[model samples]
Target: MDNPMKSSFWMLCILIDLWPYVEDNLTQLQCNLFSIGPGEYFRSLVAQQKTHLWTQRNLCDSPNDAHDRYISNHLFAQLVDRHCIDDRGPIKLFCDDFRPQNIIVDPTTLGIKAVLDLEFTTAMPSQFASEPPWWLSLAGPDSYLVRGLTLDHFVEAYMYEPRLDQFLAAMEQAEKTHPAAEHHKPLSRLMRESWRSKRFWFNYAARKPFDIDDIFNDCLKDGNASIESLDEETRAGLDAFVEAKMKQLKAYDTDCARHLESAG
Candidate 1:
């Protein structure tokens, strides 16, 4: 693993080997691990994270913020309904805080000795693991600062990263020879599409919580559509959903502040 490409290729191989065992271990507890239950847990977690970040950034007042929120929720709900919750496929382990800093490597060989920081790791839909890791580009969502280039731009640029091709090639070989070739094939296709469509951002946002605003806005921009394009009935429903969600977030924040004040 002297080269980054080699290291990443090996990482994917390890992940493929671990996928089945992790899914088997977590299948029973998946429903009970999160307070809201497995199906709704990620959704609720994302909403809570987005609410906190939105409040912290004072983004609630931005024009079209409500629309953005609505679209974000809408897209998220659709994804969850279609691909996430209730999928019978093997679940994959997701480590939210994975980055280069968390990886321990042998200095001479550059081989990965160990991966640390599994504190936030949990089982999630296999499709999640199918998407490319954000660290493949060695950049986070916030690093794309050029006016026109956003997260999608970073993903597109990273597509040409030498390591990604190596990783995918390794995955393809695994698909052909692995006992779980059927499983690996679908994930391989998904990873490619996720990269091409930049759906990786949506998957990332679904888990990152705090990044919902930035990711959602970028998604809307990529789609090249606006709130006005939504049908009248859909718009009405989304408006109502946004209003209620905003009110709930404000109340939760106010309660937390009052409790802090009393403690002080």
Candidate 2:
């Protein structure tokens, strides 16, 4: 049997590296917005007269940063909806045609010696955080985006706006309870040192909109492989399958609209 973690596997893995509350909120909002509730009213208001949907007055359609914001927010929303924000299980999506190369090394050698140097090849994108070890490059000519949790300082700045002192107070209590926990260091100290360096800024930038495109392009260029290199029959089959799935989704949405209209 073909292993799922091989070179020909295009997999998406969800890391528990995002803000749980923000993720929860986005999930709730998206679910409610698409369901048969107040969200219906909100969508109607935004799409009213069709002209309103495209007008600058639409809050969600702010022209200045709409595209980037949409992409960022959409990623967050998908993460939340798929994983329920803190369930602590890794979710994997399989892509037969989306083969990614993977690199695994012997922990003892730190990857310096010769061991196959490549496994079928699976590319796993690093979360927008720390870089995976250098060994991953040997897997194959594939790309994976890097992503991870925003450091505490970045969260404090624009992401979470809690009273700083109050948050530190809680961290203090947590430290006491978990005594030896890695994060047991006083929150007060962490806060003081947090924004003092490039640690947090570097992390924030990894997930930033401009950085994503750059990372993707870098991987594509480094791979030196063309889409034409894939098995042609497999590529054709994937295109047809995608088209069919999209048609099914459209039909489902149309049916949902008709049901809602009739009920209303």
Clashes counted in candidate 2 amount to 22
- Clash statistics: count for each candidate: 0, 22
Best by TM-score: 1
| Model 1 agreement with the true structure over 1-264: per-residue lDDT tens digits | 297755665455446444554465356346556544444655655444434433432335443576676666555544454335244566668777888989999999999999999898977766677787667677765567435466666657656346677778888788776545442445667787876665676677776554566776666343655556566776677656556557745665565556546645
Question: Candidate 2: which stretches are off by over 4 Å?
Answer: 1-224
Q: Candidate 1 — which residues are off by over 4 angstroms? A: 1-57, 145-149, 156-163, 170-190, 196-199, 220-234, 237-264
Q: Give Cα-based local distance difference scores for all models.
A: 0.61, 0.33
Clashes in model 1: which pairs? none
The predictions' CA RMSDs to the true structure, in order, are 12.1, 22.9
